[model samples]
Target: MRAMYTCSSLYMCGTRDSIRVAMSKLCTFLRHFGVVACIIQFCILLPFLCRTLPFSTYYGVTSGRINFQQRAKMLNEDRVKHANLYFKNMMASESYRHYHSIGNGTHMYLAVAVVTVRRSGVKRVNESMGYVLQTAAGIDSFARSRNFINRTFVFICNVDSQPHKHEEARFLEPYLPFTKRYGSSSFSVKDIQLPHSDLTYDEKMHKNTREKETFDYSYCLKVAESFHPEYVLMVEDDAVPHTDLSSVLEYSLDNHLVDKSKGTPVKKKFAFLKLYYPEKWQGFAFELPRVLELISIGCVGGGVSLLFGLMVRSSKTKLTHWTMCQYFVIGVIIFMLTAELVCRQNILELRRLSKYLYQFRQAPGCCTPAMLYPRAIVEPLTTYLTSLPSPQHTDLAIYDFVIQTQTPAYQLEPNLFHHIGMHSSLGTGDKDAEHFVSTFKIK
Candidate 1:
């Protein structure tokens, strides 16, 4: 019986020793063979970790709720501060002291026409400061900084038929060229006289306002044509220009829009070059070319990582079959591809830092805060816009024209201006402003 008990103890000890030895070998093998897999895993998981981690807890918060509210509050404060500053500047005579006027028969390289209407009934103090003032200040400041005041023409095209209703444009009249509708007639607000009693006054006004917007846009274009500018830039009164606005416009015109193959220059084959688009839509669009690009990047990264792993492993081991290594490589590729798709927004954020690194892609259908039309197309565009039978949003109308004509149109990435207006002059509040502070890429 004693010998049997001693044998049982020996067998248990041997089993424990065998398990420890096996675990040690497994650890050593993983340390060498699994290095690439570990790295791939880390790379794929990094974005998720950064997003999900409770880093805000270190700032005395359990979650990000307070942080988000604080950020929004700060942004509102900054916007109000800037708006007040711009309003003061617009009122000051010194701000436009050096500005050059677009006199009659003047030929300009670029003519900027800002379309504006009065915005009333806004509850916020910043909204009362007026978006037109801020936009004018931004453009005037940028033009003066770049010495573009001489070659460029900037003016306000006030669409408000009643001159008394739009005091902001009146304030700007002394500093900038101000255009208004010819007649003294105002849009009637009384809907009782209409045959359709079901439509509310607001609804009736909205329909009229839409048509007026289209007419106003056409009028501005015609006014722009009078200056004989080589390029016409149509800007919304609320769209604030970037600090590098002149530089980007110059670069875009010289590099992409103009054809200088012949001795005389000509416009490039494009309907219009859009300078701004909604930022929310500028994410990882599931397009064929973009998908192909991601796939190519994944393939190259996997191949490089695999080659590196094999080179290191070959130096240590003389294994003939690399079936496990090949499987690891496949997993790495899959992980990398998933990471590329998941973290695409981070990639775009990184690219936005470099102002010059912008791509021109086929224009997407959306708001048109800023657009550049070649001198040659201005008249034809004006004609087309005027001929439209029904009232349509200017953006949708232009998009329809582009589709019907099948003309090439392009939009710049990392938009050159910020859509800062919280209350739109078209009687609609910017609903998205609650979610996003500004659409400017750099900001």
Candidate 2:
């Protein structure tokens, strides 16, 4: 029995030794190749990590798909909240009553013309109200808060030829000065005649719509001119003004429009100052300047990482493999590249830290939601627009005219207006309306 017990103990000890040997071998193998395996795994999972990680926690700027989803959800909630508030205020009739009672027909420093038509058969969170009421409420709220009612003139240019059909415009008439285009003596469909003699049925319909749109815009400009304000702001009825609209406009006028030395206006610097541009276009696109900037950043990051790796390798004699240093530098470069790609939206949010620090760039072509035009350009722009032989979209027509005339047009960064319209008044539904709403940054 004693001999059997000793043999069993020896067998157990041998088994333990064999297990230890196997573990040692495994550790040596990992020491030799673990870095490469780790790098491969990290590269494979980088995109997924970026999408899921909450970058806002570190950067104080919202980023990542998860963060964006949260932000979009919050925006929808805020929209619902604002809609309810605006509805209540409009219903009370006390908010805008004083502004309405103030007489129009006096010259003002600024004239804001809201060009709108009746939009029907559209779905909205607030069924009783559309974008116009919310927009009007926003404008009224801004004007009253800023005490701009006396110095600034606000009016609605209902371009819906049939005034009775536009009940919202009619409802707003008592609260703000409203003008209808149907019976205006100064505007006529004949005056905006375009060459559509050879066009097909569909083409003619489109052409007519485009011509009418241009006519409506031109008429609004003319109406604004009649007020004889130094600056005329044309706002689409569906474009809701941001809370910073008043301050930004004032800043723009003071800084960009006026000559500081003489304290006189130099309106020729720009044809018009755009208050809003599409949020999608504002991202870091692969333009030449942006590419150059990115490359420079990469070079700087690579240099710093290379230096860091060299310093560590020199200090630690154990890290003798040159490949270790190379891997370290490469890993850092990859990290920087990943951060740049993943945190693009967060990087953009950095620009919004200060509302007044926005830079002006050349105006980009597309929609015209909110534009502040100089009084000097009003008559000339109207004449140039009317002279176009072919019917074109108002925005395209204006862009063409700017290019042809060599007019220096500028657009503000961090848009001061939010485009809230789901339906286009130009006879088309916005297919990307949901995308716009989701991506729009309130800051």
Candidate 3:
């Protein structure tokens, strides 16, 4: 019996040892399979990781052995912080008030962004600057009235002459009031120097004019973006707003005064607030009222006009596209010249052609009805302030006090609506000009 019991115990011990060995082999195989499964999973995820993640992030992750998902979270957090900081800082800028005033107000805003250019002759550059200053002063005085209380004004002066830059600054400083001064008073005189390159001789003579126009247009666009005002008053350095400028603009803006009464639309091409002519000219001599309804203002010297969608800006690049650029103007001219070509041969619509014709018709002397009469008379008054001998000086002051109003509902005429600018003739020794200038001088 003792021998049998001992045999059973040894048999049970052997069975236990066999079971332990089997379990150990199974565990080793499972461990190897688990590693293989992990490798397969990583391989499956590799292409997805490459496709979903940016190359820079991917490189930083694998090469640096950084956790990819963790890094992505950190990056997102950093961007949020930057955006918040930018918003906070922007809220504290002068642009903020300028923007809000434009957005929340009912009145119009006029921004005369000026860039002084060197002329070809000894013509006083300061004369144009003086005109602009007086115009600004006039506008400021008008704003003090109830009619223009909601209006805002600005003049972005870009000095074209590099060496004489200080002179330009001095010319402008006296006109602007201390309270309404441009830029930070804390900035030193040295900081006032424009950080731009000098213009070449050819550029100064020709391209500089276009640049001035474009720069002004661009500045208007930028200021418009911040304010989204009801109207924009684009003026030139030589323009002086008439004393009744605010009243004129108000009349134009008030639809009841201008358009509402003429439900069928006023039979005029270009709209005008006031067109001043030299007072010396006999009204009947020019076959026009001393100042005919500025109905035929030409888009010259970039003044006395208000147009919308005529100017635009790109937020992405902060770059601007001006309608007055050579390329753009050339394209517009071509479109006008070839409207009949496409009208007959191409699949273009008549409406498109009509729009172009409308703009052209509005321009002075472009598409006028054939007549034996002289359309405009040259006015010469100033023998003027120039080295040039004699009364060779001419002052073509078209549409002064012209205010172009733009609202979404406003519609333009087609055939004779193309000329959307101020046009007035300037001549040396014209008695009419002399009287006009003398009568219009501010006391």
Candidate 4:
């Protein structure tokens, strides 16, 4: 009996040991399985995360600052700390940072994003910048009448990153209003420079200017998203906004004045509000006003035909009305050529009524000389702009994104802004772009 009891106790101990071993094996397998799954996920998703991520958490981004050596010589670790804190407080900067509010609830409503570079023999930027400020003041005045308050801030994006260029452009400091004032100021600067060993936009450059411009423009656009303005006024340095800018924007945005009354398909289509064009002007000149030119052509042409008909009796049949009309047209063409020259009066452009009155569903966005975009689209626009593969020029890239998103865009008639520079910044006097020819050049 004693031997049997001892055998049973040993058997129970062996069973208990076997159960413990099985449980431990199961725990080990789960641990290893979880680790392997996590590793796979990390490998699969890292590339995508590198491409797109919400980076607004960092408030004070001084990444693209030029004159890095100067920054190091004149600055200390405090600037680094500012950048660190910017990232530290990134997620909360949903809307405004320091520029939005001043005191007593005063706020800024408009932001003009201008991308500029150095241009030799260029005075158009000066006039253009002045007009932009005047437009800001105009907005202020209009807002005051309605008992609403607002401010318009300008963001000048300089694409040159070389320290020497900074020295050359030092004279531009007054109009830019930065480099001293920090801590949530209305203005800021960035250098979208590339590592071009010694390639200027002039010589057979190492890098593609089109690619560089797109990136630089993209960088400025991303910067604008951080400001959180009500509407983004995208303008080029060498361009001017119209005098009635405030009235036009106010009328367009508040009332949907473009296609609101037309009851057309454009009312439901995506759109852009363009403010500048070369042939477009303010006041009476809105319509190309070629009425006198057309009349002169016809009369001069008709008289010449009649004199020739009297001199040489070539046709025996009586003249029909159609024959006389053809003769009149021929005379008109002759008069047009002899009168001035085919410089500004493009027959095709003359026919479009858009030259006379504000048009809805603006022409395809070819240039960003002077345009407006709502703040709501900035975030998505940034994402879309950055995500494109091997984009073309910045203007077309942005327009494509706008179209893809189905947004309404409008263009001012008689062009609220005018091209102000004749020379290009990509290279001295380069005319690779058609718009760059007489002042619409973008750096």
Candidate 5:
């Protein structure tokens, strides 16, 4: 009886110890789970806390607000980073050869150019010859004077898919050397196929124009992707250049004179530069400035403009190049026509407020001169006139004076971005061509 009672008591003691151990473990697990729950809740509330509460409200966290002046400094840093990233990617891809000027702090690289030839025959042949000679001369001058080192110009011939025409062959003969030297051998002269549309005549015309613009935009994007340029300047075959191409670019980039008295940092869209033509081309559409402001937002102009370039680069969805280009353009137009209208009047109001607002002097906007005007508009009034029916041909001499006088005059206006227009050229041969080649020299 005594032995049995001792064994039972020992067994009871062991069972109590086991229960204690299990209960202790359960408490430890609950504590761990509570910690995890708290962490999850904190993470969920993080965004709200950071945004609504001032940095001073946070006990342990660092302050978020830097001074207003420091904002510009931060932006400049960001821009430098953006430019560097673009340049490195271009180099790593071997998309284009770098021909940069250390002195000017501008990198100019040329990719193997591929031009599309539309026609065939003797006229086509002569055009090709002129194009090749002009292109070679321009590039050579760029290399010699502008510090261009590595540049290749490619020509893509879009010939008819039919049997080789003698005229086409002759046209391509002069450019053959260029083809062998600086260009890619991707030669196929095919018809530019149009997408099918069932619409009325006006609708068809509008649609066709849009489609063609989209195609050209796509082609430019393709070239950019294939070449991987830090920044690619697209020039038509007919575009020519004048003397000192690099100087023009330097001049363009050097325009940093901003009107501190006008426009707040948030309101300004146009960068400070001298416009070659100040006259209202359409004789002052009250909405001209507003329209321009909207256009500056980019993707709205059927996607061939500077904004289109930005959209393709910024897409988050691992979009294919072709699809991205197409969708981006569409999005721009759709968004502009719809949502942009809501804020149009407000932009104008902000412009008026800039003149009186003292705080605006320190707060600068998000555009550089290059970002404002990708291409120069030399004579808006004259272009407008010529665009009319049966305009008389005038001497090219008058153009220089008009451009120079008008550009500086516009600089004096409240329209701060006026100066960002065309910088008048000294002399003119083929102004468009000259603007294309000379306006964007590396140095």
Candidate 6:
């Protein structure tokens, strides 16, 4: 009888010990989780709190509580009249100055290879070319010299999917006058032709878009490589550089230094710099108070659960199955609260909060509106492009190449380039491109 009693006691002791260890782990997890959520809430609140408000009558009227959409609405009325004045007087003057300063240059320190495609015939202005011209002009203006732009050159490559009609090409020729290196000097189109596809319209568009973009990129690479520039800045025809871009570009490059201790100067010196994205890097939509409340609840519950476990502890007892289930329920509640607070963040926001721009472990975002490549890798980059899997979007192809080669790349905060192109060039016209029509009401 004593032997049987001893065996029963040992079994009870083992079960009690296991239950205690599980409770301890659960308590630690909840405490850590609550703390992490609090940190995330603070980071989300920082950007809006840090930026200063403009001392305007509009801000005063709204008490500075207005959102970006509301502020834009108020500013539009005030600035509408000056829009034309600024474009005609300020923009025209800047363009003239930029043109005179760099009137036909043979060599360049920085070469911006622009890939252009055909636009609707009715549209008079070439959107991408205009902004690029302005950026070069801004660089010149920043230095307070007209001829400073001679160090930079813009080469426009028109992809050759269809036969080049001189009459069709002339539609955008007006934008070319900003550079004296117009008319085949700076502007070029592919001479070869691509045969029509027997695939359905949607299918053909899906397949053809990548091929066209890849071809356009290769053309730009050839033109840029010929110049032997110290750095190649690749911009799709849809992208535009902000006027204050050069300073940031230079700062970002010099600020980030990835050691290539294993290779010579030609192997790699600097990482590829990303300059633009389609959206601001905001993570989640939870209100600051909402996150704070969730965190507080989690912390309080965790403490209560821990204390309850301690109080219920006895010499020879395991937690009841019902009690264990309650503990699990509490753990789940804590997880849901923390996950909702954290899951809204994008990779961009995470990087910014982490303060790690030069450090990259995954292949970066696959958008190539504006990117700078060091001269050291230009030859190897050319080889990579040529050997890449049969034509995909240049951005994705390049990203795949980066992963394959294990190359380090960099992305800057407050993207230096802006995607002003409203029209989607490669779409089937059913997607976001159709909304690019002007005069659409903004509610």
For each candidate, what TM-score against the reference?
Answer: 0.71, 0.68, 0.33, 0.46, 0.27, 0.50
Tens digits of per-residue lDDT for model 3, 191-222: 21111435322132323343333332323233
What is the overall TM-score of model 2 with all chains considered together? 0.68
Q: Each model's C-alpha lDDT?
A: 0.65, 0.65, 0.31, 0.47, 0.32, 0.49
Q: How big is the positional error of residue 133 in model 6, measured in Å on the Cα after superposition?
A: 8.2
Q: Give the range where candidate 1 is weakest over 10 consecutive residues by summed lDDT.
A: 185-194
Show how many residue pairs clash in every candidate, following the order shown: 0, 0, 20, 14, 23, 2
Highest TM-score scorer: 1
Pairs that clash in candidate 6: 283-344, 283-345
Off by over 4 Å in 1: 1-77, 86-105, 120-129, 147-149, 182-207, 260-266, 296-346, 353-356, 438-443
Error of 6 at 23 (Å): 37
lDDT of 5 by residue, 61-154 (tens): 4333434234433432343344334333333223222222221233334332323232334322333223322333343344345434444233
Whole-structure CA lDDT of model 6: 0.49
Identify the runs in model 4 with alpha carbons over 4 angstroms from their true place.
1-106, 120-149, 167-169, 172-207, 257-271, 278-357, 428-443
Q: Give the Cα error of residue 120 in candidate 6, in Å.
A: 5.5
* Residue 12 local lDDT, model 6: 97
Model 6 CA lDDT for position 381: 65
Instruction: Rank candidates by TM-score, best first.
Output: 1, 2, 6, 4, 3, 5
- Model 4 TM-score, 2 decimals: 0.46
* Candidate 1 structure quality by residue, lDDT tens digits, 1-443: 99999999999999988877875675466455545555655554554444432221122222345445445446645665675575564544543443344443356777788888877544542345456876776776665655466777777878776755677778777776666654221111122211224642123343487887886787777777767888889999878877667776787788777788896877687789998886656645498756765666667666765665465543434434464466456655665655444444334444456656766678876887999888888777766776677888899998888898888888877677877665667666444433344323211
Residue 43 lDDT in candidate 4: 41
CA lDDT, candidate 1, residue 246: 73
**lDDT of candidate model 2 versus the reference:** 0.65
Error of 1 at 35 (Å): 9.8
